[model samples]
Target: MSTLRVRPSTVLFAILAVGGVAFGTTCVEACLGPGRAAVRLARTARLAERLQLTDLCLFTEARYTRHASQADRHAAFQDHPAALEHFPSGSLMPPSGAANRASP
Candidate 1:
């Protein structure tokens, strides 16, 4: 009687190949899944347009930094001109155009 033996390297390769296949399947599903939601997304966009909605809010920590266009450059340092930003989002977004221009 002959016994079949699998090498450790072979087992590892087989596991990796299975994982690769699973990852590829997920990618394909993701690519195809968004098509089904296209209509719903379009409808939502139309609703937003009709309502004259503002830009999307990126942060919830502070009202000033929530929307890039609506940000108040001095709001972060309201307590003191040299105070460090209290909200983490302040570090993520750069100063808005109004802040960059020199006041005449």
Candidate 2:
């Protein structure tokens, strides 16, 4: 059998293929690493946010109209810090009678 010589085009294609594979794998590794880290961090952040909300709720009551606090239903957030990138900005105003009795 005669030896076959590789053409310039073939050599270029082979180089491109190798480069693509290397870059593709590298990009995947770099991307996944940061993405997973972000997810874990987000989970912790969300937990902290929820805890803060619960703490606030524990010490306060909410009402939408001129009525004594019933403590049954009120407005609630729809997203967690982990599942969402942005949070709605607003302060939960004290109910008509809600007061801060937390120890001084």
Candidate 3:
């Protein structure tokens, strides 16, 4: 009887693939439920037109200037739902002075 042996490269590739899967699983498991729910609730791209959120979304997720801190900004905006019409209750808050200043 003859046994076949795998090459070194194949072994390395297999290890990397397993690592990637484990890492992805860990992330998904960690982010499910509340983390996922919060993202779904707080991700405002769908509200862009109705809420005039395009500009805000751009700045909120923008790359270089890094004006927004994901953790703190999400927390701040979640607390200040008044500026967003799509908030769960669909109740609106009158634009504050800062919001009014940006009015077109």
Candidate 4:
């Protein structure tokens, strides 16, 4: 009876080769994925323009923070002027420009 034996180095080399192939595939996808999606993106953009789409909804946690343009400046702090933000999304989005401006 004959038994086939594989060397440790051969196993290591095979593992490394598979990893390198995976990394290369990821790099190729990263580079070309956007280009492939550009057509769909443009079509979506055209549809949005035709429909006069408003600001994109970012968070579903609260109505005030749902859409940036539609957010109320003081809604996040409605509970108290110095109240800590309750919604996780509140920390993610920065105060809108209008909120930072002084009222005349």
Q: Which has the greatest lDDT?
A: 4
Residues 21-98 of candidate 3 have per-residue lDDT tens digits of 999998888878677677666665556556763233223232211222222323334547564433332222222334
Q: Rank the candidates by lDDT, best first.
A: 4, 1, 2, 3
- Cα lDDT of all candidates, in order? 0.81, 0.52, 0.49, 0.83
Worst 10 residues of 4 by lDDT: 63-72
Off by over 4 Å in 3: 1-3, 33-104
TM-scores for all candidates: the values are 0.70, 0.32, 0.29, 0.72
Tell me the spans in candidate 2 whose CA falls farther than 4 Å from its real position: 36-104
Q: Lowest summed lDDT over 10 consecutive residues: which window, candidate 1? A: 64-73
Pick the TM-score winner: 4
**Total backbone collisions, model 3:** 0
Candidate 4 on 56-84: residue-level lDDT in tens? 66787876677666667788888989998
What TM-score number comes out for model 2?
Answer: 0.32
Q: How close is candidate 1 to the true structure, as a TM-score?
A: 0.70
Q: What is the C-alpha RMSD of each candidate to the true structure, in Å?
A: 2.9, 14.8, 14.7, 2.8
Q: Give the TM-score of candidate 3.
A: 0.29
Give the candidate order by descending TM-score: 4, 1, 2, 3
lDDT of 1 by residue, 6-43 (tens): 99999999999999999999999999888988999899
lDDT of 2 at 27: 94
